[model samples]
Target: MASSPLGHPTRGTTGTNRLRRNDRWIAASAAFRTAADPLVIDLGFGASGVTAFELATRLTKVRADAEVIGFELDPARVATAQAQLDDVRAGRTNFSPDLRVSFAHGGFEVPLPAGRRPAAIRAMNVLRQYDEADVPDAWASMAARLSPGGMLFEGTCDEIGRIASWVDVSSAGEPERFTLSLRLAELERPGIIAERLPKALIHRNVPGERIHDLLTALDREWERAAPLSTFGATQRFLAAVTALKRLGWPVIGGRSRWRLGELTVPWDSVAPR
Candidate 1:
């Protein structure tokens, strides 16, 4: 018999645009944009394949050759997604029938046919159910399956996609950057993302940890930028993130990205301990 999938099952809860924020990030990433193969993987795609469809839709806007494959250890979930794919192929859904997407039965191993390697892997909200210590192995197993110059985008997000954070790990299975993305509408403190951190850093949110310090400083800057709230939450967030840069935080990206409520920093800035 074939070996079983390498990871556990997720809650199987998902929606049409639950991962739209992450989809945008991947679409803009260098890995997906420059991949010769341009094949992407959606690990632990949960109950619906809609996120994969949305991902393919968004990515194709930038690279028409982009393709997406959704993976799940639960054979039932794979079947469910396949059914959705059927509808799309039949032009019964909002997605294009020509969109390149598929669903497969697999887990962290991220099996691909013809010995193909993926350009990027998006594992949103999949690791939250796993123990914090299990992260390295999972990251390694999945990252190793990536093509050179490719990355593994793994992280967690809330049900409505309002709050989220993820890590960009290289093919070597080492994290390169950490990012926090929020909706920024009627927003509260940026620290609200503390509840949705990736498995590697969720428990590290206590004092003395770099992740903890980052959230504290994030909230402090947001409060100081309160006066900008009159202009708009986006402006307020931009001011807060700019302040982070001024304070010598290794903040990445620019005004264009900050305007979208995303704050990216070097992984060392908030790595555990």
Candidate 2:
């Protein structure tokens, strides 16, 4: 058996539905549609596998044959997650037929007994503990574990399901897009996402940087779209993202996604300066 390379063990703070935003993003992703083996890795799934289980439930709608593998560095956490999954298997917990979730003790190496790489990997709130400079290496290591034409979603979110941001990385170990998903009710300004930006762009939220300009543009557009608040948070968000695009912000995705309080931008539009 090969040892995992992700040396440091995380704090293992697990919670329910904490990764809803990312899960939804994966469920709607094209990667799931064309995957030969629709397997997903819930990298660093913390102390419990509830988030992994939820991810399976959500993705099943897109790919009924999908499977979710939750990985943790701590042996104890892996044991706990496995126990929870077993309970679900034995009909101990309420689970859908398509929710095939499992647990494994692996670090950044993404240990697979059959040397099978996954179609998608979600590592949320995992790298925030490491130094900013370590991000690129970690991204490369994890991205290398992806199947051909696969995706790597690395990001952070608030404790609850609200504010979140992530980068969509390709199999080439390069980021293609930056995404921000937020709960828009009473939003002061879209720039608030700077605090939760992934390690790559978090520190680059300053003048002259692409991320800084992107945030500034978002805030400005958000203010202009305040009138859409009369319709609801969803309408306001749609209007704001649209405004950003009109101002050459390179915003991607459409109203259907923006309706969920989510927006994606090309990597070059917000990459570190």
Candidate 3:
């Protein structure tokens, strides 16, 4: 482990439900659901600890023992989150007073007490500012701290949480899957996720790249499913994802996940070519 946190401080930008989509996805993950530890890390949770609180609230529904720790490299941010945690404890906030949440000063090293490892680590929007070349090391540093069969969800999303995408890295630091999520109700095109892709794929979304091809195909299918929008955006998204799979895009998951405006594929399907 690094002597100090191995990353820079984030912009400290965050809001209520800004990570709702991610929270939902993590809650459904087998890593979190099946982990004996049930401990999740909200790496770089920004200026507020609300995301960590919200994550705990959601994950506890799946497993009451679920706990979350908001991590930041900035000491001030950790203090701020601790203050919020205090508020929650005082019953001044709407959050459960007993919310199993905490704040810590750390970065990609994912510091934990007593050599504890996390079931899953959520690094949403953390690496966007770093160079793409820095992604592998960052992924490795964090993934190294995962428990057996754990995962590292590293990705980006709009501040409003409307559009999101992430790479699911295994405990070995290998990228296993990539996921793209959108707010389908008024989504113009699925390709818009290009702006919020994880650092690994953000720059690779171009001509002849697999990511470019995936986005191009997704846009086409989304347009083709435009008629289904009359039934609702969820229906339209489901149709598009189904069509994408039929077209041999290596799409993963089923209608159940697609209905949330999410489409997943093997990391290789969109890996930089």
**Per-model C-alpha RMSD:** 1.1, 1.4, 0.9
Against the true structure, candidate 1 reaches a TM-score of: 0.98
lDDT of each: 0.94, 0.86, 0.93
**Pairs that clash in candidate 1:** none
Candidate 1, position 57, lDDT: 98
Candidate 3 similarity to native, TM-score: 0.98
Q: How many backbone clashes are present in model 2?
A: 0
lDDT of 1 by residue, 56-170 (tens): 9999999999999999999999999999999999999989999999999999988887789999999999999899889999999999899999999999999999998999999
The residue ranges of model 1 lying beyond 4 angstroms of the native Cα positions read: none
Q: Show model 2 residue runs off by greater than 4 Å.
A: none
- lDDT of candidate 2 over 25-69, digit per residue (tens): 999887776899999999999988899999999998888899999
Query: TM-scores of the models, in the given order?
Result: 0.98, 0.96, 0.98
